[model samples]
Target: MHVPDGFINAPVSAVAGVVAAGAVAVSLKGARRELNERTAPLAGLVAAFIFAVQMLNFPVAAGTSGHLLGGALAAILVGPFTGILCISVVLLMQGILFADGGLTALGVNILDMGVVTSVVAYALFRGLVRVLPRTRRSMTAASFVAALISVPAAAVAFTLMYWIGGTTDIPIGKVFTAMVGVHVLIGIGEAAITALTVGAVVAVRPDLVYGARGLTAPLKLRIDGELVDAPAPAPAREPAAAHRSTKGLWATGLVTALVLAGFVSYYASANPDGLEKVATDQGIDKKAKDHASKDSPLADYGVKDVSNARISGGLAGIIGVGATLVVGSGAFYVVSRRRTDDESVNSDSRRDEKV
Candidate 1:
């Protein structure tokens, strides 16, 4: 959920800022192990895809709507550390460029939407995959269940934050009940989106899906009437054709993201999302302040002075996708490069020692 300014008091908001900052710092270090030549670009695309899909809000209740939070989907596709960074990039873009989420409350939104959802969903997903059959179907199912719970988990997180720093005097019980209830309905939509996306990726390039990796059972050999694990296969050199295939997948994903944000987003539901609806209904937004970038050309997901709603929104969406891809890819590329540099340095050190 994109927590706007004035909802949480200054003290709690500052605390959340510190927590979010620390989490991002930790994720950056963890991502060094996750990002690589093939997966780094894919991670960027995942961020852009999540940014696009989030625009297509689906109706959850009569007046409430929900969109893909992308935590579960991202974590399933990439690693959890990278997933957190992906969502953070999207949130940062939306807050600064689109004026969708408040700048002052950026930390709160990142903590709830990025940190809590990704961490909780990935942990649950790992646990479920361990228990369930090790198959693509099981992975997709795990994604569904993980996504289903992540939304409510985020709602609970928000409720706790509000309890501590809510600007209004609304009863804590009412806020929690309403937030969790509506988000439960919203979670179904999240689950469906996550499952379908994860399934699609697993079908095409299971190697690219971090959660799907190692799902296939290890080979076993029966010798002397006893079964034992087979010798691990040596690493093979990647062929040019395989590299071409990765490029093809990346092209396809970028095209899909463009289509979703540029064209399909026009048909998305116009109703307020789960958090907005709950805030309005429960008076949690009584003191909500205007977004700092409300006057930006691309504020509110529309181009300034653009009379055609369709064209304005479409341009904004395209811009957002492009910006997110550039920034995200740049960030991930740096992390991947650092990893490679570290390996090279270690190799040199070892070589020198042998000399």
Candidate 2:
């Protein structure tokens, strides 16, 4: 959930800022390995997709609603390091542009929503995939479980942070209970969305899904009472097929993201999210202050001076998707370029050694 300002004390907020900074730094390095020519552009699409889906908040309880955290979905579709960066990009955009999350509490939101969920979800998904059958169905099933757990994990993380630097004197146990309870229900929605999205991607182009990599292989046959892996087949329209496949998938994904944010978001729940609901109910938001960008044209996911609610929200959502795609793609492109350069340098060094 997006943590607003005033919920956490300044000291704890500062600590979270440092932690968030360190995690981003580490992820940047790790992402060098994750993002290559094929996956780099896909990483940007993942960020934009997450930004879109998050706008469609579904009802979780009487008044609480939940949205895609994107940690599990991103990690399954892209890579974990890149997934963290994706969610971070969305959070950053929402904070500065939409005022959805507080600038002062950016670190808290990043740590809970980006770092905790991505790390936990990816680790669990990897473990489950190792034990379960190595099929697309198993991968999707594992994605669901990973996403289901990640939400509550994020809730627990927030509860601990609040215990340490809560602005109010709400009992930690009660806060934890409420936060976990609502988020547990929210997690089910997260799981279903993750599984469905991952399944869809795997169905169309399993090669594009990062988690499914290395899971599929050529079948083996028994010959002379011994089983041997099938020989690799000759290439068939290899380059043309790849070019067309990636182009089609990219076009389809971008179109889907635009549609979800620009049109479908209008029907999303208007209620507060899991964290916000818990905070309000527990008096944790008693000291919440106004967002710094509350007066901005695009604040609160609406265009300034736009009387039509639909038009205002639709424009804001479109702008958000476009901005996220540009920024996130630019970031991932740089990381991918760095990886290419490093590999080239290594190859040169090896050749010189042989010479």
- Tally clashes: model 2: 0
Worst 10 residues of 1 by lDDT: 227-236
Q: Which regions in candidate 2 have their CA more than 4 angstroms from the true location? A: 215-237
Q: Per-residue CA lDDT of candidate 2, range 1-355, in tens?
A: 8999999999999999999999999999999988887778889989999999999999999999999999989887888889999999999999999988889899999999999999999999988987886566677889999999999999999999999999999999999999999999999999999999988776667667777666555323344776555333225658777777787888899999999999999999999999989988889999998999888899999999999999999999999999999999999999999999999999999999999
**Model 1: per-residue Cα lDDT over 232-288, one tens digit each:** 322367467667777888999999999999999999999999999999998888899
Which lDDT values do the candidates have, in the order given?
0.89, 0.89
Report the lDDT of model 1 for residue 201: 72
Q: What is the TM-score of each candidate against the true structure?
A: 0.94, 0.94
